[model samples]
Target: MTVPAPAADGLPTRVRIHEVGARDGLQNEKATVPTEVKAEFVRRLADAGLTTIEATSFVHPKWVPQLADAEALFPQVADLPVDLPVLVPNERGLDRALALGARRVAVFASATESFAKANLNRTVDEALAMFDPVVTRAKADGVQVRGYLSMCFGDPWEGPVPLPQVVRVCRALLDMGCDELSLGDTIGVATPGHVQALLTALNEAGVPTPALGVHFHDTYGQALANTLAALRHGVTTVDASAGGLGGCPYAKSATGNLATEDLVWMLRGLGIDTGVDLGRLVATSAWMADHLGRPSPSRTVRALSHKEQ
Candidate 1:
């Protein structure tokens, strides 16, 4: 298939960025970021033209103590012009989120049993079953739900996952009324070949490609390559974090999600318009990295800063 040419304006006409830095990014941090800092980060992200930001998770504080402030923080930024989605681990988490007037929530699952058990404390079937009530309740309450499937490419414990397993979970999520499904390369082991093959399998199974999204970590530095493969298959929505903010706690040495600035830069180069200001996003990422006392993991940020120097 011939890749489409760049737009007349020298960018793709559109792209969607789901910012998870605030929630997934900070969830594993050793230090608890003050509520004010989290709020400020969300506000700055909105100002950077991000329409979908994963603000926080409402799971039990014991599992992820960093996001214990979801309730307190949601109300403070309820007026922002963006979909601030919080991760809801179960019905109880859903209840907390609903109390805070959450309009969007995400449910997560894993393809492998071991990862599922370690991360979500359930088997694959059990985890998907848990979402039934959560999705139903969220839909009834007029809240949109997004589904996430981790270990789409390969699992650290289970090795490479079967294509049918990924397709089945995806179909289940979509059938359960999830607005979208984000296929995650949790350990960053997906290659362009695997991406193409899995997407093809998903499409053949009657799944709508547009309703599918890809989330790649740069552990193997293949996030961009996998993204290109997804785009080639007409997959529209992509999940990325600013400054490359999140990593898998279960997999040591694994890097965070694909960087938003880098993703935006690539999309712009391919003529896709993400509606994000590249320079502003880079600056915001830099500021956050500084505030967090760590240099950004984004190659785009490093390159741009180097160019300026």
Candidate 2:
């Protein structure tokens, strides 16, 4: 595939793509992946020039059996030169990640009450309360903590999540010592306008654009559009999965995340630097798709790999 000519449209010169294939991408798989495969996936993503790769969650095995080997998996990829951030669901999860020498960790929170209850069995406030110490202790240990706020756009149980409701949870996370926040369109119901509006509201609510990341789902085929809106608003960090590999296991309506290959294609066309080699990224996703026994859902992956064949 030919690279799109550089076009500067007043966007950030460089965008950080948080690769989530190893963790969020494979978390919901019904079939268990070997620990070695998961480790190799992380290695390949880093090799593709992704700096920050979410490795694995420290959540309990019973809840997510696919990542039961977190202890075994984390150690194998701990020596990589990239930023390997793991998900820590609570204080105990934080302890688990810290024990394995994880320097960066993330906590998942919900912007709406229904998703809070469905995912964590806690109220909105109760869930934030759960993460208070997780963020506190992680910061105390000098670890970088990223707060993930899901259902920022729409919820399955609740139709449209209010802008203020999402802003409140984001504020709570930052106030609790989270180094940054990732706004998640859990059900993928966000549009470019909604994304811009929310970012503006958060800015007004004292959330800096630099401290924010956007995670969009492609359920409505709006992930890239929503992402462009964020970029125009100065959001430099974006969360995406290789080969479109993730969905909310808790939210049935949620679909695969924004494909990293697709996002890179867009950024490259726009003259935004992401340090990613598109050829290598597509190959990695194709390799992963082969391992999963399915064709990659990423359009760029399909298009480029098909021409190679």
Best by lDDT: 2
Candidate 2 residues 17-116, lDDT tens each?
9999899999988899899889989999999999999999999999999999999999999999999999999989988999999999999999988889
Cα-based TM-score, every candidate: 0.95, 0.99
lDDT score of residue 286 within candidate 1:
87
CA lDDT, every model vs. true structure: 0.88, 0.94
- The residue-by-residue lDDT of candidate 1 on 1-309, one tens digit each, is 113347534222677898889988988788999999999999999999999999999989888889899888998889998899999989999999998889999999888898999998889999989999999999999899999999998988888999999999999988988998999999999999999999999999988888888999998899999998888778879999998998988877577989998898888767787788777788888888888898898988888876777
Report the error of model 2 at residue 189, Å.
Answer: 0.5
RMSD of each: 3.1, 0.8
